[model samples]
Target: MSVVLDISRLEPRQVLFAPSPLSELAEMLHVLSAPDHHPGLRAWATATATGLSSGLADRLAEADFLWHATRADILLPARPAATLAEELDALDERDDETFVASALEISCMAQYHRGVPQPLISAKDAQEARERAAIRGPRQAAFADRLLTDPRGVRAWLRRLFQDCEREFFADAWHDARTRLYADARHKTELLRRKGLAPALTAISPALQLDDQQQRLVIDKLVDGAGTTSDLGLTCIPTAFGRPHLVTMITPGWRPVIQYPITTPDLPRPMTVNLLQARLEALAHPVRMRMCRALARGSHTTGELAAAHGLTAPEASRHIARLKKAGLITTQRRGRYVGYQLDLNTVARLGSDFLDSLLR
Candidate 1:
């Protein structure tokens, strides 16, 4: 579904724009996990994949569940940390109970809708821990048992994974990206100061909408949830690695975060052609054309699009993916159904954009 932030109680001063190394690291790991989904990171992913140690590779696989729960507050600093090392130190300093609880939340979130079990933070005994762990699955159940028995060991293992990932690739990557990321943050901060929250959020992503009447910042996400801006405030981090989609951390315990794509001024002329081709190709298919026309009228779920076009589910999905990859459509998830809407603005600009690309 969507995450609705009750912004009525929030002040303009409560919304902050900052760059976070930890948030960037999370996105980097995600890109590494599935590079195919992130074309921009393909080269880096390929280069980095070659040198990963066997131990780190195994640890990454084992801890893959934690990345799914990136929304967990433990993985992120309350405010922007100066460096990845600084964030790592903060994470390492967390108490055993808090560390285990955060890990559990991350692992549970691997399967959508499987949120953290109740009273887990206060679970004092083994039976309670096992019961809470049972709700997650065999992997998490075992993890919970390990956490209860040896939290320090679990924390050490996770820390080592983070350290190894940094030492291997992200340390250098962050060094290169940090300046651009901070510049973007400063630009967003100034924009926020001048234009206020709604415009700033809109500038961040089309997936974000300020529902003024409802006093909510509505974020279009696959997962359905709600959170409020904490006394700690809301932080928006501009990321180089996190692109195409906005990542929100609205889980209850955390200071709400919106990790948005960095806006760059330069697009090489060659990239313009590539982007134009992708969009043109996405629109070229007859079924996709029909689907876009239908979507222009109103939003339609994949099943609805398939049924209307008399296509199989896989075929419909393939078409939808093409349009989505081209940035021609936006998705809004409501319960189990995700509805897609065509971006008429991008569609309208296609003609001029193509000409501009060719001429320039």
Candidate 2:
């Protein structure tokens, strides 16, 4: 199963590369909702989740559907907007029917993420929304009922939720990430011009491939669908928060957008000394050093690490967790037990990273 986008009619003029602040915010909200999927962002997401106001946390639970249907039309600007405020302003200017229709449409798609075999709504109407609301469980059902009964109010409520996310954390996060996002977009745009469309498109992610003969951009996905980029030209949005997955909005009536991951890992953040210290501390302990020596040879189960070190399972597990968090090791689950392996590259980089931190 895959998504095939016909690029036969796609023109260079139709292709756009820009950073979508609202889209990034939506993806960040998604990171908060499902931190496990984003291991690199787990720490920040956990802290952000802990610090959110009670009211905002409750709203996030209700709005959990947004993360799953992130490529929904309403969440994305019609054209590239320079700032988050600009995008939010454009969203505010939309008509009532557009808001209602988008909400209903996105709600139906959210059902699919919940593992529903078919969409809850066949027709995008108030009655269909009401019917879906009845089975959406308590939290989402309330959000759905509000959308059908008071669309305008729902719009305002959602805007506030988005605003709260920006004011609280995403503003700072976007500030830190925008430079990297913009650079990645520029690089991809240049790739399109210099290397041609196929290489440029596939460079966005490993899951994407271009079939030159078929004039199709084949995306490896679980769901199956095919569409042409005739009416809606392709817009490529590079997102820092959207790592490890690619999202597309090729559904009929939505502006086509591909929210792809940035090719490189996140730029090294500040607090270099603290980071180096944490890594050093992870290895400074005698038990951890021996564990690393053993793991350096090959992967070992938690039971093996414990037995070899003459320690209890809990003690070995604690050391393993600390080392894993410090980026010194990687873990793979094997049936009932978890296997741990030393991350040689990260360990080797520790010396250089420490030296660079001190001099630069």
Candidate 3:
């Protein structure tokens, strides 16, 4: 489905690229809940100690398994509060009825085939969704039954669940990642001021395209909602983690919210390799080759790689460092653990350049 965002009349100031820790928390929970869907995150969760247990993990597990029904819009309200403290305060003060209704709406909406949030805003549309209910999980079906009626109870349970997760699973990581996101936002803001909207936005994600003629910023598979920035401006936030990104178009109306992944480095890097044999030698070891294949599939920790290879953590790390120095693999901080992914481009260039030189 396509998300048509009407940015036709938006001023430079109308579009703000900010950071939201609360938003990132929801995405992080989703990643934890659905490991198969988020392969890279799965590796991180497997390698790290999340400290989530009992209620919080179980609830997130339930919600994640029922993601289609537990729509991110319902869990995230996508509040555009300036700070995490402000956002937390707002969420804490949110009344029972509104909170309950949103939860129920999301629970009911999860039964449908659509992934967008716009259709669930109306009573008629929600009723239509209920009529066409298509759910796969028994736990979710049972929970939805209770959620449809006793929303207040379910809402309370959710508040407790989130508090547990925030304290146990997310608090520390949230602080560091939030700081990075804030810096990312500030950098984008400076770029927007210097280079204007289109250039700055494209820099955020090459997938973002501003069509002035249609007054739309098109992002392929970003969301399933068509939104307009007629009144309130658009807020684009740099997320440390959302892969493929997420968009919030809670109409009637809030400022359109875009949460895209900060996947690439902000600045260009000089080619750092001193010798090509270093790369070839790094791959010569069978242990390193296994790690490379594992990293190529997704991301891996030195610990996980060690366990797989029957090596100690220090031994595995030594090998990993050699590969990193060779520019064959690179590390990324994922939650509490560091993950490694292969530098396929460098690997290809090494092979191609070597063959070209020999032929010459």
Model 2's number of clashes is 0
lDDT of 2 by residue, 314-334 (tens): 999999999988888888888
* TM-score (C-alpha, index-matched) for candidate 3: 0.62
**Which candidate leads in TM-score?**
2
Per-residue lDDT tens digits of candidate 3, residues 14-66? 87887775677677765665556556677666643356565555677565533
Per-residue lDDT tens digits for candidate 1, residues 42-103, read 99988887788877877776665565434455655567788877887888887776676666
Give the better candidate number (2 or 3) by TM-score: 2
Residue 159 lDDT (model 3): 64
Top-scoring candidate (lDDT): 2
Looking at model 3, which ten-residue stretch has the lowest summed lDDT?
Answer: 266-275
Q: What TM-score would every model get versus the actual structure?
A: 0.67, 0.68, 0.62
- Deviation in angstroms for 63 in model 2? 1.7
The Cα RMSD in angstroms, rounded to one decimal, for candidate 3 relative to the true structure is 13.6
Name the better of 1 and 3 by TM-score. Answer: 1
Clashes of 1: 0
lDDT-wise, the better of 2 and 3 is 2
How many residue pairs clash (N, CA or C atoms closer than 3 angstroms) in each of the candidate models, in the order given?
Answer: 0, 0, 1
Q: Which pairs clash in the backbone of model 2?
A: none
